[model samples]
Target chain A: MAINKLKRHIIIFVMFVTLMPTGTAIADFAVIVNKDNPVVSMGKSDVKNIFLGKKTFWPDGSGIDVYLQRAGKAHRSFVLEILRKSPQQLSMYWKQALFSGTGIPPNQLQDDQSVIKAVADNAGAIGYIAPEHIDTTVKALELK
Target chain B: MKLSRGIFCTFLFVLISLQETPTCLAFQIGNHLSLNGYLSQGYIESSGNNFFGDSLDGSFEINEFALTTNYIANNQLRLGLQLLSRDLGEEGNNEILIDWAVADYHWQDWLGLRLGKVKLPIGLYNQGRDTDFLRPMVFLPQSIYDENKRSLLVAATGGSIYGNFFLGNGGYLDYQAYYGKVDFREDSGQAQGIRYLVSNISRMKNLGSVSDFDSENRYVCGGSLLYSPPLDALRFGVSYFTGKTDFDFRVGGRKGEASGTNKDFIVLSVEYAQPDWKIAFEYSEFTGDRKALGIDIPDGRSQGAYVQLCYHLYDELVLSALYDIFYADKNDHSGSKYADQGQPDYLGWRKDFGLGIRWNITNQLIFKAEHHWVDGASLQLPIFNPQGVEEHWNYFVLKTSFNF
Candidate 1:
């Protein structure tokens, strides 16, 4: 009976992994920058680095200010697709950075609209929002 | 008693400050200044030996509290400091001290500088050892990160050059080189070891009573490099450090000095992480040479290593297992040679198998429990265990932490 229960747990775990969303099936969100910013396109690696705080400056030498949604579908999609990290992993990464005094995590907003508004007001700001939430005040980058 | 009062007051202040905003990730005074901290309390129990303060009968002597502040002067400059108070057995006693303080200047993605008391990069996890919320286990692998020698290896007061470099499609590399002097305290494990040695020497050579024991570091310097290859989620790293220290004491009203040098101290590390699980491995080796009171202690190379794995069962739960080993003298793994000198055979080595569970009760709160089956007595200092040590022992720990 114990063996059967263990086998059942293993099967369930495998199924969970198999059914998990890959995050690559659809590009439901757009990476956005301030309208005044000159950057037009970004590679996946570039976005990853910027989000990770590894890339701190733009070509114009302006500091990059990052914004993110605290929690939402768009936030999850961006974290999984662009950052290539699970939400929990990302949270742990930021916690590690904060506690170690190495770097600070990006400012998190409550939702997509807040992030979009924050990005629009800061010339050096970058954020992500669902395609339907993109507005004229922000320039959507062509993610490669 | 004073230290305990101070720690209580600090803890009260932190609690009061946190009451208003329970979910704040970091307290921000303004756009440029932020504060973060963590507090942990733990209990330990053991069978067959005492570990971390009379653990054979259970103890709550393990606890840590730290507060860090960061001020960003501009895009290129930042200042940070952390104040820490901890109690581990009879070591820390909850006395507050400066953990690390640094003024960091970032010039570019490939170049940066830091000046002040900087953390030493010994392994993949050394820099974050103080943050209990960062790992799945209550204690890190002791073979490589011996908690007893924490004061000697935690940080150094000086400067460092560091940076991250992109390698196009081949991933990236992070590097840091540092130089400074480490602080030595009378109650530190290293100092205790020196005192124990002096006591033995006093008996063997009729050197008489010893007192006023102290130690000083002449210098410490090191560098570390981490490379992430094209393989996703895989990282490889190597860190090296060397230093010299002097021990001073009085024997029979006569001053005596002993100097020790640590050479070729190195650690090699590798880790691979997936969405659900992670695995890590590290190995370290170093040679120590000492000359004390006109007697030259034979140079010995020590070795340590561990392999650990963690599985994320849920967003808030993690399970971890570790196998760690350490040899006081790599050439005498069996300890027979060490036993020939009158000490217990187990004194020369330690091997441990541990299992742990971590529950993230909340983003800012965590609970962890772990159990270990250990053989050997290398890390158990003789000064603390006057009754002698057992060849086999087991210990369990339960810890909870709150952070912001």
Candidate 2:
């Protein structure tokens, strides 16, 4: 009888912890471009190739450029969680592209606000920032 | 539908908030090691002229197929390797070799050491930048950074120390210093257990050691400082170096020994970089007789610089171009010039132009093509081809690269 009561108590405790509502959830975002971009959506793999300089130009040959914020912890984390790569890994990729004459480094902007503004104004521009920072001037497309 | 919209809004809020939160150090020592590698290929076809011995203003060929790999044992230690191949004019002619090997140790956030073979810290791109997958041009300015000549032992077989310091405004600073020798000899690629040494004056060899290398031993040091400022989008870096590349020099007949200087030249560099575009600029000149064969030929000056630009057109394409110039302030010569009356004859100034495109088929695959025009290459060897004209034979190059 004593053993049965202990087991029952353990089960109830486990249930309570497992079911508790912590109110925290993993975050996700829709990577967007200006509404004018022909691209509707892309997946993580597509984004990786685009940023890595593996893909040099756009499909239509209009040419593409970019604006990226300086490297930061939050930015790094978002890139890791969303794009699944560490900063060093990403740096190496850029290093290869930059030295090979395959592509140029992105344009650096002060913050998401500026990045959004620049990208929105230029049809050939692309960038990533917080979803909340998105304005009507630009559009956010979902990463497939 | 209403409920879905609310969920989406909450998601957006969380994403924005995450960008403002503080995070801990991501670099740490753990046994769950991670290994990374890069593969690249390049091809060139120039309507202009460049090549060793002859310049063919209109010859095009496949240039290189290469791959590199990095192995990180933990947050504190790392290893790297590179293999490259170039197919000459026909099926049987090929150039191949090991480009780098490094074993690094992290002592702290501000300092660390690397043992074994590694790149000598010279400029922003001399050692840090070189690879078909990384650069925005089909070729780095030949006038400024290409060292196919005696910069031969580009990567050394020695030790190096480096460090990084973080600054606010989303910026950071870094520096590196190195010491040691190189693997030099008739068959360096396969030779071993050889020691080399170089003396200061022309014929006063026998001063130190000479085993695997021709003859050399000297201290080396270099450093770089970078600022990103509050303008997050803009990053600027300046770098410098003073040291010996190789100490071994087999002097000709009499006074037959050579010694390289412990300190020879200095390099000044600046690099502006962004995700989609970056430009590298540098100037290198001699000092303290940093030389090999003859008593460290002091005061011979050489300087060069290049500006590169690249733009990604879309998902699978990129367009690029670069302009580079290298010449002696005292005289103009081609890539190869003999010593004349106390001065390096004339390794004329050179200008390079290029364009390219790349396509990524998948995470592990890519395809790229590029072209270059070489002009006034008076000092550069191997790549510089000579015709009657000072701007002689220029060749075109085309290559495809693959890695697993």
Candidate 3:
């Protein structure tokens, strides 16, 4: 009878752990721009175009300086979710643009902190990072 | 010896550059100018026929080197130029030539203009063929992108207008329209093919041996449209080109002038990509008319198509497979009518199955190997193969490339 009671307790504990709520299933990354920029929100397509080097200017007629992380979870999520491409595919796309003399790829930073710093420094710069990395120096753009 | 020296110098230069700046994607000369280049060396071997040199005996006469520079004057204007030197058997011969020099102006998201020597938007991959790292296969589908006709089809000296349009949930559209003139070199494969044709015609017409062959492209006009659906990694495209060429040849000390018009050259393409796999299909048709010495040659339409699939086994390794087909005359798929002539029936058609592997050792370095089993001689020009061509043949190629 004591062994059976211990088995039941173990089963109940396993079920409770499995049923516990995780904060959010998907980790959310934030797209950021300089605090002084006029842009507050942007559509997914607009972000895609800017990263692709197809959209060069912002609404205020200033050149947009795009920044990206070299390789990280935030980079992977941004590429797969927003750009609908793998990191390798994005790299190949940039290489194609370079070789074809079409456009230049954005400057790549090593980490989220570097990307955050880059966007914070340039008025027209834009980048993405983990939401926890967001600070007062940069404004997080609402992804439409 | 000259070829060896050229290869050595190019290899040494690339090695030094890589060592100096292994991580640089492009060397920046200043605030406005940036430079990039790539070098590729390839070896080819064949079983039954010569290809891209004396491939039957294992040829190393395939290589390419190019340097491209871009100067961004402002947010709206950019100037670009590329100097290229390549050798494929008897063509190119490692002579430096202008691949493209263009002045591009971007007005807005939906419009742009480019003037100067511009790369033609033929099928999907023509503009990127010079860059070995752009594709998984060492050679693209030969049926649609015949290596022999590369010079004639690569680019044109003219102007182009291009644009991209967003379609909300529908997708996006990219369009290009161009007008230009193509320059054909004397040592080019197109020129050699023309020479061979003139010689054969002379023999048939009893006009004696033909010599002093010259050809000029009068003008070319084309347009291309590509659409990407809302679905991820799916695209469909169509391209059309029309051009005319004038040729002059001396037959037994007599000068004769002829002209050829390419009417309704069209290509349709589709490609789909996933994270680890991609598939592409393209079909092309060329309808043309030829007149030689005021004698009308029979008009015919040629057709070509290919289906390619690529799978990435790892982040740096890719495997590709291809099935390509070509016909000299779309109406005579069996080549029975072609056999009525003296030439072999296989000359009228070609069917090929190819397999390739590409390894991206680094962001700036790549290596590739491919083999093709061919069942016809359609694009194998007689000028390159005095030893003759067999109906069943195969070829292998190994290539390595470095870029910065």
Which candidate wins on TM-score? 1
The candidate with the higher lDDT, 2 or 3, is 3
Ranking by DockQ: 1, 3, 2
Q: Regarding TM-score, does 2 or 3 come out ahead?
A: 3
Count: clashes, candidate 1: 0
Deviating ranges (above 4 Å) for candidate 3 = A1-24, B1-21
Model 1 per-residue lDDT tens digits across residues B109-134: 78999899888888898888888888
lDDT of 3 by residue, B1-404 (tens): 13354664565486545566454345665658877778899999998888877888998889888777788897788999987888888888888788888999988868899999988888998888788888889888988788887877788999899989889888889888999999988887767776776777788889888878888999989989989888878999999998888889899899977777878889999999887899999999987687776777665898999999999999899999999999988999887766887678898899999999999898779999999999988885467777677889999999999887
- DockQ values per model: 0.50, 0.05, 0.48
Error of 2 at B174 (Å): 1.7
TM-score of the A-chain for all models: 0.82, 0.70, 0.81
A1-144 in candidate 3: lDDT tens per residue?
A: 999999999999999998996644655578999999989999988898789876788997888889988788889888988887888889888877767656666777889889888888899899999888899999999988
TM-score list, all predictions: 0.93, 0.56, 0.91
Per-residue error for B323 in candidate 1, Å, reads 0.5
Candidate 2: lDDT of A53? 35
Fraction of the real A/B interface contacts present in each candidate?
A: 0.47, 0.09, 0.49
